[model samples]
Target: MKVNVKYFGAIAESAGKSEEVLDLEKGSSVKDLKNQQIKKYQIQDADSIQIAVNQDLKNEVELKDGDEVAFLPPFAGG
Candidate 1:
């Protein structure tokens, strides 16, 4: 299964790219991909990172082919 991964805010800065397509095995979970990317990019503040699948916040959700996964960092507003 192939998933579209997107990085936002500090995540994108750390990754040095906004988006990429990942080829994952069937039954992959959001957590699985998140952990891989975090290690791959050495992303900081992993505890604060959030994963969104198909526009909905998800953690252990099972991924499907062509799903869109977004890596979002903490956001602040005054």
Candidate 2:
């Protein structure tokens, strides 16, 4: 299954791009994807990153084909 992954803030800088398409095994969880990308890009502060699946924040949801995952870096309210 293929899913769209979007990177924001520092995550995007680490990834070297804002978004990409990744192919994963069917039934993969959000944490699985997070682990894969975190290692692949060597993103810093992995624990501080937040992810929204298909526009919804999820921790352990099963990913489906065409789902959108956004990696958000920790931010401060100004």
Top-TM-score structure, candidate number: 1
**What TM-score goes with each of the models?**
0.93, 0.93
Number of clashing pairs per prediction, in order: 0, 0
lDDT of 2: 0.92
Residues 1-78, model 1: lDDT tens digits? 899999999999999999999999999998889999999999999999989899998456789999999999997768
| Cα lDDT computed for each candidate against the true fold | 0.93, 0.92
Residue pairs in candidate 2 whose N, alpha carbon or C atoms collide under 3 angstroms = none
Query: What RMSD value applies to candidate 2?
Result: 1.1
The regions of model 2 sitting more than 4 angstroms off are: none
